[model samples]
Target: MKKFIHEDFLLETDYAKELYHDYAKGQPIIDYHSHLPPNELAEDKNFENITQIWIEGDHYKWRAMRALGVPEKFITGKATDAEKFQKWAQTVPYTMRNPLYHWTHLELSRYFGIDELLTPESAEDIYAQCNSHLKKPSFSTRNLVSKMNVEVVCTTDDPLDNLSHHITLAESDCPVKVLPTFRPDGLINIEKVDFTDYISTLSKITGITITDLASLGEAAKKRVAYFHENGCRLSDHGLIHAYGYDYTEAEINKILSNRFAEKSISEKEIRQYKSAVLHLLGQLYAEKNWVMQLHLGPIRDTNKAILTKIGINAGVDSIGDYPQAEQLANFLNRLNNSGSLPKTILYNSNPSDNELFATMAGNFTGEEIKGKVQFGAAWWFLDQKDGIKDQLDAVSNMGLLSCSVGMLTDSRSFLSFPRHEYYRRVLCNILGNDLKDGLLPHDMKWIGKIVQDITYNNAKEFFQFPSLVENLSLKR
Candidate 1:
């Protein structure tokens, strides 16, 4: 019997097969954004079992298990690792159409060399096999990343982080360049209850007094310089939507004073304050020549019961139908008008906003940069095959797909690098089908170069990380 995930998996035509195998398969991955723990990579930690690596902290699988009526003890509570693996195996058969089904099997096959379908019947042997593989010295975190041919990994970090682990990795003999991405969502989210506390933490870290917006911007600017000195070339922001409300400096300072005094501010004031902070940070990013990434449109933590019990990122966030266009344009235009619009990548969690994001990206594409404002890869709920294709179609139809920078994991798992491969296959299949239908000319070399650029070259150029450039030159 034919294996479900063969070499030509997801490649439906001969052109697709050739494109994937000949051009896309050999490219290195640049996971420019991920939630992977830098400490694990720095320590070269090895997992005790497959469940530790695969199931723990993987909310995607947890959501599926919950939908299948699996007990909380097995999902996230004190159930033994073996018991948790059993529950996940049982839930696998029911996840036929979900991306989890593909991701589970792909991770198993790629990492453990296990090709058998994950089901209750084959669960025990597969579990044992994965655990055995995890015990190998070659399965350490650093080794695992190197094995996947990853050139660079930019981990998400807060402005408050000292980046000791990144410093360690930089001074070590580790092959992959683990860089830090400056994420100031904590600083930008003034509406959170912990906003004052976060400001205190930032003030301590930067040795600045945060009495108002000016001091706060000064503290944040110091952090940006600190992060840049520590090898950061990117900044990330997670918001329901961009804040572009108009506010004078006095108004923002008053809003800050009220918030710091434990006074409740109106929604209008909240928007103005967030806009001011975001604009200040955007200027800092431009000054530092950093890439800015905005992950937008998700209404996070909707289930208050789950949120209260499990806290944030508890698999309760859903796509939001927020008004994105007007505010997003205003935010970008504000930065542009001030001559501080940095290279930006926009990721939309809602699939309905595909063209909206792609075209919005087009509106800010100048400044002698190729794809300066990218309509980033399909993100969150939209990382699957159909979503990937939809994003590609939107970019190709509304913008220049050839200039696209390609896929990212946006994941927390070290074993998720195969997503890049999955994306490549889907990309080749799309182009191949276009060729087959006579939509594209029958030119292999040019098309193949386009495939390679989207897979690797575009990102390499787009990010312009010093370590990546130095490493590529060394290879040459």
Candidate 2:
């Protein structure tokens, strides 16, 4: 068998190796969506050890360790850092066939130069080596980002966020463009338990009294303007599915008033309110020429007991099976009819909706824009190799895969940058196999251009971030 993680790890053929190394590998990253904290990058924090950097805030690993019967303390509880690393080391070999196995080894090899398979036997030595490297200034958060050759990273932020850290990074001339993406899920999800508290937070941020739907709209408008002023050109939403309700302003106002007064609203009213807010936000995004991202189909916080112990983003969520196509089409059509549909990306956590989302995106292509509407890269549970192939096949069959802006980490870890590399390899292998199998012609130049675009070019062209470094390939 081939050596593990050699130069051509996932490349099964000569064509795949050529496409990856010569074209896809060197492309600078444009991480258009991620949950990386702006404050850490601003401060250039140096992680103390492997566990601190790898395990902390990484729910993927937590989920795997839990499956291996690793206890709460070693995963997310009050265990020593070394203890946590040990437990994860013990769990790594069991992750074979899971994307976690590849991701773990990739992170290790790329970041720490450790190519040996991780096991309980090698855990201590590997941990010590990574910790030694972590102590260096070159491994600081900013340097880590630079080392990965990432050109831009758009961090997810709330409407009420002050963006003070982003401002700090911008003023200091940090090379990587750490921009903000407006994520207003809490503001739109009025049925959430903390909806009133969130509204109060928004009111304080905007200095607006949000007693009615009009005032709430005013608050959101101000926040959107503020985000734009801070160099934000993207807005994101997480939804069970898209909503498109035709409700009068009076109805929305009543729903807002009821929620504000500690009164209950019906399920239908909740849908109406969410639809109204989404439409208004879509209009704002279009007016400002911002890219809107919709991350659909996640059923979050299913295990209430687990949530109480570890809180949100701690690996208790699963894919949702909500009806998507009709509402999604209506939502986009509403914006398109108003001549205010901005560039959009639709990401479905559930793989079964791949074709539905792909065709839905194809329906709204803009006259003046190339790939104005896109089926986003496979996300969350769908980021694995098989899932990547599924998404690519669907998009190629139903939409324009060439114009697609490619992968984003959608992660909270710095080491997760290798995920882009993983995607590039998978993409190159898929295209190369097609060539060898007589599916595609032997035109390497044309295929290489496509690989480069998906790896970096599409995102650079698609997003309108003000200070995005001129695309390096274009600069040549």
Candidate 3:
């Protein structure tokens, strides 16, 4: 048999086959950033059907459905599960060369052990077979996480969340460390769709009348404290740019006060106002030793009419054409130079910012830095093979390979855990090919150890989740 001919995972020789095959097999996954439901992790549900698990919240599938000329009744409306699955199956063949194409077949091959390509012809059998397995008890959320060797899964949570669910899940014996991150884009925005509603909710939660900018900041800090009490070690923000235009507290407070009085603020002034809040938040994060994640460069709520009906993040956000590097670099350096910078992990949506973020991650290291700075993996729109490979190459070429954490799915689909397997295989193949070409002295054991480290160890180490790895070693 030809080596790598029939193999789906990129192993190509006897030594290569033996070494990578066993190694690339599911090891513990450390998902650093994801949108998984905290309540579901707390409950750990078994799926009722493949369509329920895969189709329910998959915006990618929804996009494909939209492209396939599938009606909204079937795409995002009140269609039956069976109808939605049929629509998705019909659209699958048209997704050729798209990352979804590889990801779908890969899930089939990896999770279900089915080699047949999915198309309109084989859709029924494939769906039925997947649904059959979904009925089994082992297909539950907790079990599936355990199956994929996920040790730690950190989910995004709003600052206003009570996080009682996260505490309950963490206290359970499920062994997956499901942590919450503080995301406060709504709190920082004066232009958010439900800004008034959000402020009311925040006021109710913190018992502080947010009559002005100072009170607003105080209320947000009070809520952030509650999040920290529940073991939140990280905070996240999403923005079109890192607020670079500098301003004094008085100037920003004037902007906020005007905003509160329903006076229109200029786009330039709005950015400065947001920047002042971000700077203060950075100070707070540093004071508490919390990691800060900035997810930047996406133009949110693009389709105005669709946004009016469907709402934000319901598949309306698109990549912005803005240059992301300079402002982001300035934001970090502004904090760093002032000695108030927290350990930061930046996720950039613009593909052009890859090299810029690469150098940014390497900028602050060693004992001088209060804590480490990091480049987060390819995220959201860039969670595909080509995009991931680009990020890996940029980070490897510029920074220490050992410092780069492997991958995270950043997906809403329950079946997306197979993505860890996909990333690992690509990672191992890249390193393996490099060894074959005499790039790093042809040391298989050392290289294999590094490959394993990137896939599993690096993430845990980077996230400071060493207890789980100690437990995994005990299991071994």
Give the alpha carbon lDDT tens digit for every residue of 299-345 in model 2: 99998988999888889999999999989999999999999999999
Give the per-residue lDDT of model 3 (tens digit) for 54-124: 88878888777787788878877888887788888888889986878878887777567777878878888
Please give the lDDT score at residue 109 for candidate 2.
92
lDDT of 1 by residue, 104-199 (tens): 988999999999999999999999999999999899999999999999999999888888898888877888999999998889778899999999
Q: What is the Å distance of residue 197 in model 3 from its true position?
A: 3.5
Best lDDT among the predictions, by candidate number: 1
Q: Tell me the lDDT of candidate 2.
A: 0.91
Worst-scoring 10-residue span by lDDT in model 3 = 467-476
User: Which residue segments of model 1 deviate by more than 4 Å?
Assistant: 469-476
Deviation in Å, model 1, residue 340 alpha carbon = 0.8
Pairs with steric clashes in candidate 3: none
- Using all chains and alpha carbons, the TM-scores for the candidates as numbered come to 0.98, 0.97, 0.90
Among these predictions, the greatest TM-score belongs to 1
Clashes of each: 0, 0, 0
Ranked by lDDT, top first: 1, 2, 3
lDDT of each: 0.92, 0.91, 0.76
How large an RMSD does model 2 have? 3.2
